[model samples]
Target: MTGVLIPGPGKRVTLRDVALEAGVSIKTVSRVVNGEPAVNAATAVRVAGVVERLGYRPNELARSLKG
Candidate 1:
């Protein structure tokens, strides 16, 4: 039997990618993903835009620990 070859890195979108796209830090991306308060409205919107564009989903296990 032959197996199929997957193209590119098979994995989920990471926080680092979101941060880079949003021009912010990983912590800012984390803040947006986790729905944390105190983040500036503008910054949150920018981060959210990046997250949506990249279809980035936070790692639940990691997010839980941060809270």
Candidate 2:
């Protein structure tokens, strides 16, 4: 369990969680996740690692709700 993140009982790891862990903005994480260009290469790599480590998944339902 070392170096692993455990979310709350019913909480899904979120973009904000990754951002917080990666020390980047939520938008930056979004760019990295969506393959958008222009993010700092090192920052993107860090964010990617946090995303994987935290098991972060964009909530499809939340995206649909935004539209």
* TM-score of each candidate structure, all chains considered together: 0.72, 0.81
**Candidate 1: tens digits of C-alpha lDDT, residues 1-67:** 1121222467777888777777888998888887999799999998898788777876789858987
Q: Rate the local accuracy (lDDT) of all candidates.
A: 0.76, 0.84
Candidate 2: tens digits of C-alpha lDDT, residues 1-67: 1343658779999887787778888899999999999798989898898888888888899889998
Q: How accurate is candidate 2 locally (lDDT)?
A: 0.84
Cα error, candidate 1, residue 66 (Å)? 7.3
Best by TM-score: 2
Could you list the CA RMSD of all candidates, in the order they appear?
Answer: 8.7, 3.0
lDDT of 1 at 34: 78
Candidate 2 residue pairs that clash: none
